[model samples]
Target: MSDLRRRALAGGKTVSRKARSKPESGLSSGNHTPNGSPGNSRAGSRANSRPGSRYASEDEYASESENDDIMTISTNSVSGEDDPGNTWAERLQDRVAELQDRKRSSVQGREATLGAYNHLLKHHFAQRQLDKSVAELMPILLRGIRNGSSDEERLRTLQAFTLTVLTCSPETIFEQALPILKAACQDADAENVKVEAIYALCIAVSYGGGSSTAAEETLDFFLEIIESDGQSVGAPDSGAVVTAALQAWAFVASHMEDLTVQSEAAIEAFIEQLDSSDPDVQTSAGVNIALLFEAAREYEEETGESFDMQYNQHRIMTRMAEIVRDSSKSVSKKGRRHLRSNFSSIVTSLERGKGPGYSTAGRAGPNPHTGGPRTDEQGEFREFGYRERIRIYNQFLLINTWSLHSRAELLKTLLGGGFGIHYLENPIVKDILGSADVEYIPNAKSRK
Candidate 1:
């Protein structure tokens, strides 16, 4: 195995002491399960542990009807299911049985697991279905991660577990799944498993009705992973883990309404990553820095108060510009090109104080006298910021804010082909976006 992969697999399983302490900003305890809280035990009902604003408010139905909701959802037909016995729950149950049969070949078990996940992505699961199934499903899935025959099987199992989190009600799984997922983050046997676990935590906290304080604590935990670069945590020097941590941190940070509390330290940490040997790490850091700037701008618009975090914006912009034109030979030509493209967007975002993509107002051509490159009205290089498109039913949802953009990217990575389907049908997704389908269109049209 490659060195990077080895380190990733050897990631630390312990949460840092610093992460466990209450955040300095009066935020809630960052621990996955607060001390003495009902979420303290695996068997504890997470859905009832805390009063949540989003997921809890929506889960007001009677407990007796939980099974009814599950049956109703499980009985619904998914596209291309011709067999009467091939309902989602039955297929899932069959796969689980196949997986549990010790006599089955490893290949058969892996395929069975994948088949179950494929079925999951085909339809959204209601809260009742999740509540009824999670008790049985989570343990088996966790076992797959620990005992699966190959790294591929373990990774697929992790992916399936994340899909289960996303497709079902977040509250149903949040309390029960968070600690186990954190244990996966500390997995010393598989680096990819650790990476996938971090992503899973991001999804759970974001969709599972975690408070802004919980989100802040989650971001802090990821930042520790990123800043340590896997060494302090007893993991190897793996850029993949750092990159995953960085991206996951940004994914959760993007959802926060205010970043001022974390801005100065977070931006400084991200700026240091601009010097990373891994190009992926560099770009992820750059994008996150831009996201901070975007958050600051949004905060200013909302509160009309200047953000207190102070840093040399000029220096950061200069470093991004240098990255845009870097010609170092140690980096591959493709890597260099990607850095240029990513940094160009970062530079644009910093220069314009907005997310990347060209200006909505028609751009004026290059300087008439200097005959320079294409520039916006502000006379800066017209660099395009990365944008993701999601089709919700008939309308195309444009993700433009750094927060929404981060969520879209993370969802796409987690859900793969099912992102569009979830974006269309999942309430958790809609809640995260806050009517983004309705909010972003006019802005996109204006930017056209």
Candidate 2:
């Protein structure tokens, strides 16, 4: 609700949702379908036009008619003799003709993105007019990707350009697309645009280009976002944007190889999520912490030395325990207790000293440490496999296995949910639940 954050989301303008219709966002489901790529068609002719199509987020804004930001409407109601006129068709033709007539190198910014979209329209609506190649079209996109005035403009430009890049050679993308995406991720704009930028950055990684510096910068950027205690998370639309951010952070974390100081930073950020008022945020944070653990484990296995996740593991676990243990008006007992139970399950299933081979989704295989059925009837898409799963979980088999016993109070804190099995059939920590001496730590400080 802070003025600054509001302005960021609104692109410095204030408009009621019903009054102002946003344009379509550019997050593509697969490879983008810019004008010339395989299976490519004019984006204008296909996207969101179809019912039941997986459209962009509902917040998408832009249109030749409704979105003032994306479209430049003519002042005159009637079309002049020389001008194509005020009709949408004529406007579309005029824009495309203008782009084709203008020098490509000069195109930049929001205008440039509009031009690219117009180009998609030209190719899709009228192939006889089609003469541009993917190679020729890319520079305009790169320019637009770097040039948009608003977050919406940048995101749309990136979305329109996605299929083209996906279809092109990866090496070219490594050189051209990578920088554009990195800049977007680092740029100052709305949180939604930043979320898109992070997504584009992660998408760029799949292309196999960029320097180590770019990689480090991408990794560091998300970690910074993670550690940032931005007040924007409270906004209604903010969750959708933050969810994109968390997902992007997960993508970057899983792909990056080395374990650096930012790993600790990322872990700290996830730990902070434990205190979020939102249950979804809490759940995502809990899930992603497991990701960092697996990544750290991967780095150590690849190299002989320890990756030094040693910084906050104990303290973080202590906090998780405290959240679950504390029964106060301040904390959501159900959510916190459930999260703690999940953490304990992860601890129980993972080998004491091994790194996690599986991902958060358990794409590798069935988790060995957690021997019970990984399948859930409600988990419509959850798929657990074999050794790939086995190999993946190995890294986290022994995660946070340090002696909490030395701090008996912390051990007791973890026990608060020992028999709390809302998440699974097993006790949160079976071994601890069976112990004779452990008692719930009373009156732990409230999670901030």
Best by TM-score: 1
In the order shown, the candidates' Cα RMSDs to the true structure are 16.4, 19.2
Q: Which candidate's lDDT is highest?
A: 1
Tens-digit lDDT string for candidate 2 (1-448): 2321211011222323321211111112232211111111212211111011011111111122222222222211111223222233333333333333334322232334253343333122222222233444556566767876555556655654543333332445656677676666556355555555555665565443656666667666655555564333322334434444555566445445565756667777777777765544554565567666666666678787687775556666666566556534455665445455455533432433322222234433344557554455423444231111100111111122111111111111111111122111222222322322222324543222
Per-candidate TM-scores read 0.68, 0.45
Q: Residue 95, candidate 1: how far off, in angstroms?
A: 2.4
Give the clash count for model 1: 6
Q: Which ten residues in a row have the lowest lDDT in candidate 2?
A: 48-57
lDDT score at residue 70, model 2, on the 0-100 scale: 27
Off by over 4 Å in 2: 1-132, 149-152, 174-189, 205-208, 230-245, 299-304, 311-318, 321-448
Q: After superposition, how far is residue 309 of candidate 2 from its true place, in Å?
A: 1.5
Q: Tell me how far the alpha carbon of residue 343 in candidate 2 is from the true structure, in angstroms, after superposition.
A: 5.6
